[model samples]
Target: MNDYSKAARAADRVRIVELDAEIQELQARIRLLQLERYPCQQRLDAHRYPVLALPNEIVGEIFVHFLPLYPDTPPLTGIYSPTTLTHICSQWREIALATPKLW
Candidate 1:
């Protein structure tokens, strides 16, 4: 090719390399942003479920209220059973187990 065409091709190749480097930098930044977002996103989602914020004592009290009245026993395993409380989540499971009245 002519000298002008050779210079133009060389310039194009250099621009291409620069653009590829920029793309790689942007991709790395995106990955970092995603990593930072994960915990914040989890916190935001946790906030959406306000019940999880209740104190353990209050949760235990709620479980007591969930039980049948005095002298009545809840089933071993069912929707209305205290075991159902244990099945809900780790926090509730702890609360239910700690509250002697539920047993």
Candidate 2:
């Protein structure tokens, strides 16, 4: 190759090395960010259902309101039933069963 071509090839090799280093730095930064994100994401996931954080009394009251007005009663089984609430989760089942108004 001519001197000019040889010089250009050497420059290209240097640029390629610099680019590879930059890529590695970016990848390391991404890994660090992901590591930082994980626990915060776990915390966020813990609170994903905000309603679950409410006090049992408040949740029971909310369940009471969800039923038909006082004079009417929800069915024993099916989507609208309080039994369905018992099936949702242990905490909810305990709350639903304890709340006389639900039955």
Candidate 3:
């Protein structure tokens, strides 16, 4: 009975060591996969969308579409304002400032 109990404990310890080694291997594999995915994600982000790549003239036309029909004073605050559009990017800021129709 004593020998049987000792063997059972030894088997359990061996299994625990094997499981720990497998866990470490899986974690290393996950790190490698994440490193591989980083460049692909960066490349995808580098490819600009059609709207963002549009000429400033076209972007200015789109900005003009946001204006009120009766020529009310532009809103000083909020995301809907032309000022908010300028805050998006340097190019948009230049286009918004250049287009007098937006003012």
Candidate 4:
């Protein structure tokens, strides 16, 4: 029937219009998310950078472990010995004193 065919065509047109609107909204949301992530993407694009962050106390401990000390040495030599941990930088010396294991 002519009426039936007309109704079918109208229904088809309405479905197609709704599908187009849904596709357009999906594209808009994708564009918005891309803009939101643009800065983070730029940061990720940069090269890696190296850093030095070992604490002075850690350095002093390491040097103390490597030092040569004689337990039987006189107290005077213990105070003036080059092998003493404090002969290094003042900061390292202070750390070594606080961490007596360095002696």
User: What tens digits encode model 2's per-residue C-alpha lDDT throughout 30-60?
Assistant: 9999999999987896699677788999999
Candidate 3, residues 8-102, lDDT tens digits: the string is 99999999999999999999999999999999977675575555678989999999887766547667578767888899888889999999987
Model 2 segments beyond 4 Å from truth?
1-42
Candidates in order, TM-scores: namely: 0.62, 0.56, 0.51, 0.40
Task: Return the lDDT, model 4, position 92.
Answer: 53
lDDT to native, each model: 0.90, 0.91, 0.84, 0.63
Task: For model 1, give the RMSD to the true fold.
Answer: 5.5
TM-score of 4: 0.40
- lDDT per residue, candidate 4, 1-103, as tens digits? 3666977999999999999999999999999999999987666644321111357666656655555565633232464443465675565566666765544
Model 2 weakest 10-residue run by lDDT = 1-10
Ranking by lDDT: 2, 1, 3, 4
Best by lDDT: 2
- Pull out the clashing pairs in model 2: none
Candidate 3 wrongly placed segments (more than 4 Å):
1-4, 48-73, 77-79, 82-103
What is the alpha-carbon lDDT of model 4 when measured against the actual structure?
0.63
Residue pairs clashing in model 3 are none
User: Which structure among the candidates has the greatest TM-score?
Assistant: 1
lDDT of 2 at 95: 95
